[model samples]
Target: MKRVLIPVAFLFALFAGSGSAAAAPPIPVEPTTETLDCPGFQVDAVYTGKAKWIDAPVASGTKKRLKLFTGVAAASTATLTGPAPTSKVISLSLNGSISWSIVLSPEFDIVITGTGRNLISDPQHGDYPGGLFLTVGKVSWSLNAPDYPNGGITGPGSVTDVCALLAP
Candidate 1:
């Protein structure tokens, strides 16, 4: 349930082009390691993958849309630091493909389809649950602002609490 998306999103921003530039073509992501920010501690995530740009942002429209396919193999390990401290090797692994559609209209919106991990850390909406979830099938989330990690999630699908595997 740890981010395959987090790594992918990083690559996305690198390959992503803004207005006046169409989506970049398929780019292979070199194997790399990145630090992941979790609720309590941090994890070192290593991954290799590729993203194929399917749709460029609409050239002219109030709504900007982008589509793409991504597949990655990601794994992570870390020690819980804030609470529930453990010496056990906190680890997670994921290999999967996903389709993502991002839009900007009234707000920056996203819809991801396929199987992967999603972190929901938004905690300001009246009795909302916050955690990292291994979401299978499909899940949708919206950020309060672009490039923000915390956001609210709402969708129907199989959800697994990843902390159980990583720490508990």
Candidate 2:
């Protein structure tokens, strides 16, 4: 019994010394920079185009939109960096005038669902969710105005007008 117990203890020690049992070092990630092509539409184009008025004239300004591209490159270099999770809806309105353009760049709550992709144009509302579908690629998303809930169509103070100006 003594001999068997000693051998068991020695075997346990031997297994414990195996490097494989040790935790592996955390993988180091390098910081990377990537540009999401706006496709000249989205927010950037909306600001560029619009009609001017007096009382609440639409201001004129340059707007730009960017979507992150995916794959190994699309993956964010910062392992744990991104917008804080939120559920509130974001609103974007550009009041354009001949001389002035109102530009609002709000950080939207977007979810990444379905196939993994870099950029995806949300079909429903501008409040997009999902990681972005790779197959669908980059598409145009509609921004429904809060002040004026005009269904899916664009109306006064709507993203539709801005998209029209951005039309490529």
Candidate 3:
């Protein structure tokens, strides 16, 4: 019995030293102020939400939806410095049926509602690398859109990377 216990203890020690049992680092705390930027637009807005981890086999998964305060979007981007035109969302939906997600890892889904020359039109569809950057406190994550022209938007006119405008 002593010999068996010794081996079991040794195995446990070995596994623990191997880093398999190591605790995951604490998730980054969300910041009070959030800023979202795109190639041709930028918005510094206040968000109300929290990010939490999701159960998974391996790797950490976080899902977060930050709803921008009403008028914050317009107030933040009041001055347009980028090449893209001054854009605003007449109506935005980032909760309920539609929500924006920023995953620290590689997979995430973010959705917003707005229409502009260089912004996400109605019913924007994307896979990964959706050209979205969401800043939560000090940590930030970039959500990729599908690899395609005009952010998978049909019809004419240049609609390239309009999703970035919706980040917050």
Top TM-score hit: 1
Query: In candidate 3, residue 158 scores what lDDT?
Result: 28
TM-score of every candidate = 0.49, 0.16, 0.25
What lDDT tens digits, residue by residue, belong to model 2 across residues 1-168?
000001111111222222221123222133222211222322211111112112222334554433321111111111111222421222232121111112245643221111211122222223321121122222222332231221222212212222222234
RMSD of 2: 26.5
Pick by lDDT: 1 or 2, better one:
1
Count of clashes, each model: 0, 22, 7
Per-residue lDDT of model 1, residues 1-168, tens digit only? 112233333343344332222334434555555544444544444444443334333455554766644432233221222224553343334443345667666556665554554232232233332344455545555433332322333456566554444552
lDDT of 1 at 87: 32
Between candidates 1 and 3, name the one with more favorable TM-score: 1
Candidate 3 has what TM-score? 0.25
Clashing pairs in 1: none
lDDT by residue for model 3 over 1-168, one digit each (tens)?
A: 000001111111222222221134222223333333443345443322222222213324443443321100111111112232444442222211111233333434433322221223222223223233211111111234333443333332223333444433
Give residue 123's lDDT in candidate 1 (0 to 100): 29
In candidate 3, list every pair of residues with a backbone clash.
31-137, 128-144, 128-145, 129-144, 129-145, 130-144, 130-145
Please give the ranking of all candidate structures by lDDT, highest first, separated by commas: 1, 3, 2
TM-score of 2: 0.16
After superposition, candidate 1 runs with Cα above 4 Å error = 1-28, 49-131, 145-151
Report how far off residue 157 is in candidate 1 (Å). Answer: 2.3
